[model samples]
Target: MSTAPTLIFTEALVLLGGAVVAAPIFRKLGLGTVLGYLAAGAVIGPLAHIITGAEEILPVAELGVVFLLFVIGLELKPSTLWRMRADIFGLGSAQVLLGGGLLTIAAVMFQLLDWKAAVVAGFGLSLSSTAFALQILNDRNDMNSAYGQRTFSVLLFQDLAIVPLLAMISILGNQAGSQSASLWMDIGIAIAATLAMILTGRYVLTPLFQIIARTGAREVMIAAALFVVLGSAMLMQAVGLSMAMGAFLAGVMLAESSYRHELEADIEPFRGILQALFFIAVGLSVQFNVIFDNLLLLALAVPLIMLVKGLSIYGLCRLAGSSHNDALRIAAVLPQGGEFGFVLFTTAVSAGLFSNATASLLISIVTLTMALTPVVASLANHLLKGEAREEIEEDFEGAGSDVLMIGFSRFGQIAAQILLASGRDVTIIDDSADRIRQASMFGFRIYFGDGTRLDMLRAAGIEKAKIVAVCTQKRDVTDKIVDLIAAEFPHCRLFVRSYDRVHSLSLRARNVEYELRETLESGLKFGRSAITALGVSEDTAAAIEDDIRRRDEERLQLQAVDGLRAGTHMLYNRPVQPEPLVKPKRGAEQPEDAL
Candidate 1:
């Protein structure tokens, strides 16, 4: 007898197959994973009808958002958040308030639904996709750019505003008979629930993770991670608040924990897959029949909404001190609808704020807007590609020296400064606008751009330079710059900064001649201080440090040839022969030259 395939099995196949097929293709086409997942869901559920109902998948997939907020929370502690007060409160608050207000007015003028419904639509559309925008910014290496910071600050504010908006929705939409609990009671429960999660994270969860980690089982650790997420989510849901918000709070509390990095590493893959599923569910929710019936309407409405949102955000960015080009970049990248659009829309509808038809239309428009983000950002980038500054090009034209520094971060700055003080003409090219700006304040002619770019190197006169020093400790980036210079400008001497012994060996494997572990020298100096603090003579401590340094350098040089044998020798702490230092008595005077 023939048996029907299990529904779960079929659904899983459809979801996985869709993602597997679409992700690489869209990524290859430079559209990014957001569009890929969206397209997959559209084809599977809406068009092909392979997976007809996304209802069962959506609630679990919604946890994707919870995980995302959790990760975001981990990255932002109270102190870090305080330090960004200007960006968060000033720029961020302005974007949401202004964007929401203008949209509300425009909707009211057009007589879209009514004042109440317009309020929902206004604040709803004001949120840009955090995941999408961050991905695009990181891909372009612009997350540290002024525009990038501004856009992120605004996004952060929007994420926070979700809690207040929820409370507002419940207040406005709760009819007399429909109320489940008093507003004050619900508020109290929410507060108590948040506190409980924080306490549990600090006292209960940390110990629990510590115990679980000792088991030495990968599955147990993964299980523990999932337990924390789902447990916190359930606790929050029990208290009449957003589950995702509770997860975010839990993450914030755990931000200071020693296990944070471990937890993050475990949760990241799950977040990505679950988030993809969430996007897929969004795609499945699209009603193609309705879309096709009003294709022309959507075609116009989508662009209109995107234009309104983009210009509104751009204007706010400009008002907040972004340059014309920077404002354009922010506008182009953030005009799209956010994932929160779906969340708030569902909440709005359940509260009887708008009809299903209106919701569907808005959802369609938002999806289309998100799909067009990459195109919009590319065009905006093109618009910002003005000719290289005359002053910059002219300065680079003649500024060839014996020294070329590839980074201008804290590490690179010290190296560049020492060379500059010693009368060397050093051209430092850095990718960070912040670093470059700070360097300019100190009268350094630091150029801002990626060192890996061949044109940038040529402009910096890499061919004519003598020493190419890559002082950035990011091994991947350091290795890339090292490869570029070694291949094209082999005559130049290369000095690289490594994070540790392994990183140094990796650089050595790449045939890098000069590699200094970033912390090794400072650590040695600190070691000398510790020796002296224990009552050893300063001269003896200094001599011991010198011997240690000399032997380590000798080992590093030996390891540069074949790393395998030499690396093992260094790793095992093989003994080195050296003369014992003679300590001076307390009454004795130091040598005159040493003094």
Candidate 2:
């Protein structure tokens, strides 16, 4: 009898019901959503035993990781990865090698397995859970943080290393030179597949996106994006590489494409739910029998492993130039084992390098780590309270705005209102934490920081910005920022808020294209309204107001020139010379003769 439909339905219910219940509970308990997702998986897999296809669901769940890698790759330009090459190759390599080496020694001492099995176990367990770490870092908006970036570089390296690691496991299992040759073959195929993806992405994907985008079909665009990710992953998998690796490579290749943002937009929804499913699968796969039977060993193993890995990562991050607090965060965030340990342990067992008992114990330990990841992240974040710069930066990212307003004081509200009214993408940045909070309460996504900083500007997408309006109250501070913006981002149109007549003159001297005196227009409006209220008709009042504005502008223009002259005179250094204009009567009279 064909039971495929029934099986599928049951699996769907298990996943759906779990998610439906877990989200609210986790939220109410003030736990991370990941905890809810994992709980759902546990409830389905271990508690109700609703589905008999956890293993089948494993591969399906892995699609989330694949999509996630692809999306991460989209974020990682070659330049970004290259810039962090030291961290990737240095800290990342050492994390795997030294960490694995230490773990292997510990495993041997504990008599967990023979040296060969321990070696495999060590390498596998040394990896931090990428999904868990990135999810936390991303949620907290620490993706660009010093500690977050360094730790992520290590995670990325670990992702890349999975290919070789898997190959190594296979070779070790067979204990054969032939397996090594097969790996070389796979590597060649992997290279070819990668090149194919790049070339195809460069030539084909953008055009496809454009055609679909023109049709205005959201569903088609999303389907096309899915195809791209899944296709790349499948191609890589077909060539002896992980699907995530392939998808990631594809994503990186398309990072700079015109369609990159659109692709991200389309793919994000799928990646989130799928990634959640991937986490749920991890929870579901946790073996209660193995844990209960070997409770003492697993318990002893989990804490020890986390401690060693934590210390190792902390020292490594410190060596990489992170602050002590940041190092503590990096350490705590990454001590947990990764999802790949399951694959590694399975490969080892299938290859006869490890017995069923050892594999079960190791898998349990890995699952424990995965389950505990959110708690660790929460604790780390709590300990680093009043120091959540990562989260602060993250809130700005979601705005993905085109216009960045540097100050959110009363002056800033004018530009903000205009932009908001016009339905323009607008983001506000201010140094005052209290002001930022107030704006947030009033439904503004205000980024709190000293906006004059280049790092802050970049974080707010200064490069991609169309307009930047500086409305800070201080003239000198405004001028300093104007210079920075002029120097760094000449393409951006700057609209600076001037404090008064002198500030406006200063701005004009600086060759600012747009300078609005803070009180000039408002004071003019007050005069116009008063004139109309006194006796004049509204139209006559407007005419009189316009005429007055013209005269004042003419005077202002003359004054601006004089201000420039005055500044030049102040800075002037006359050469040592005879006293000027003692008597020039004959030459001075020449003006009449010339006329």
| Candidate 1 local lDDT, 1-595, one digit each (tens) | 2344676777888898889999999989977777788899989988888887776787888888778767766766767657767877787777777777877787898787688888888888877887678767867888767787777777776766776666667666756345435655767777787788878887888788889889999899989888888888888777766667677777877888888898899999988888889878878877887788789877876777778878877787788777789889999988887777777777888989978887877777677887788789877767785734423323465556778788877788778778989988998787776677777888988876678889888888787788888987577888788888888887778888897877787877777768888888889999999989998887777766766777677666665554444335443334333334344333445322111
User: Residue-wise lDDT of candidate 2 within 384-474, one digit each (tens)?
Assistant: 6355453344445554478878998998986798899989888778887777777888888887767778878888777777778899988
RMSD of 1: 11.3
Taken over the whole model, the C-alpha lDDT of each candidate is 0.77, 0.80
TM-score of each: 0.65, 0.66
Clashing pairs in 1: none
Off by over 4 Å in 2: 1-3, 214-217, 382-595
